[model samples]
Target chain A: GAGVSQTPSNKVTEKGKYVELRCDPISGHTALYWYRQSLGQGPEFLIYFQGTGAADDSGLPNDRFFAVRPEGSVSTLKIQRTERGDSAVYLCASSNRPYNEQFFGPGTRLTVL
Target chain B: AQRVTQPEKLLSVFKGAPVELKCNYSYSGSPELFWYVQYSRQRLQLLLRHISRESIKGFTADLNKGETSFHLKKPFAQEEDSAMYYCALYGSGGYQKVTFGTGTKLQVIP
Candidate 1:
């Protein structure tokens, strides 16, 4: 079975620029999650989507960060006016249910120059 | 708020030696504890969960509510076990977010 996949394994952009990271979750997965991992740190929760609607987005640092999982399978994490502090590995995961074991994808490394 | 703590950033042990990776967590309500492992060049994968009560790849973790700890342990270490380990806590509260620790890097010396 195909696991979760993320597009643009690595992306480098200038500060104040905009970037969007895409995620393809496993088929039939109803739960999607986004996380950011900085150097020497673990992955921090960013947002969560149940089906096409976001169930928990409190982890989003600020309004500049937004995510959408329309159609309930694919998700995109959008960052507006990116700051150098936003540079990190963005991870995406999916699960069958809310509390089930999550399957993670190869993270997309975003570097804000 | 929920928090996970991995006291050691790195743990080096020789092959065939016993291994223990400590993890402690703090949460207001009952939480689901998990251990995630990332091998070199591999994505993070679930190693085990406290609720399963099953060992994976010779690794096992026991959850202690009184101590608020879920420590991963194994009787014998293998070189393949060298990787990054993250302890996570998922609280089923209103937010339903999973909190992760900084992670521990395990180095197995041959």
Candidate 2:
């Protein structure tokens, strides 16, 4: 696409429910990243995908947070048994290649009620 | 452990005033520093990276290796300069290992 694209700019889900956030990176960007941003803080890295494999998933808070880049183009962030504390803006970014500047999308603001 | 620290959470300056946003990092190896900005209801975008050595929007940041700092500066602040500024770092070790500081919000009053 043009810039990075995230789905359902806002989402409200109940606790214990499952939510998925999607990201469509810019064309030809091989490195995709997922981040979480709280109300008053900068975005924190959650996971990074280089090509079809996850290059780094060290930042995932716990087992409930998972992500996948099946095709290396679009990615999805899945949260299982969501909690209210999970409420925040989920950001997605992608770079042309490794060690390059990332372009971010309009983040998906998730609200777990 | 590598970390980025942005001490000030809020800064207000009159238009044409000089502005500076502080950033400090702790890392064992070399650092790749960058400043990202977010305007009202906008996506986060790169303002500048220390490696590029280019200034954008009348702002510049010099990476001081001795102090482990990369401070953003503007000689004359404009209302458009108001935004959330984040200090980020990527180490030479991992390709995707990046850390960001708690952002500083700048308000340039016209």
Residue pairs clashing in model 2 are: none
Q: Candidate 1, after superposition: displacement of residue A62 in Å?
A: 0.5
Model 2 residue runs over 4 Å out of place are: none
The numbered model that scores best in DockQ is 1
Docking quality (DockQ) of candidate 2: 0.74
- Tens digit of per-residue lDDT, candidate 2, span B8-65: 9999999999999999999998898999999998889999999899989889999999
lDDT of the candidates, in the order given: 0.95, 0.93
TM-score of each: 0.98, 0.97
Across B1-110, the per-residue lDDT of candidate 1 in tens digits comes to 89999999999999999999999999999989999999999999999999999989999999999999999999999999999999999878666688899999999999
Every candidate's chain B TM-score:
0.98, 0.97
- Give the docking tier of candidate 1: high
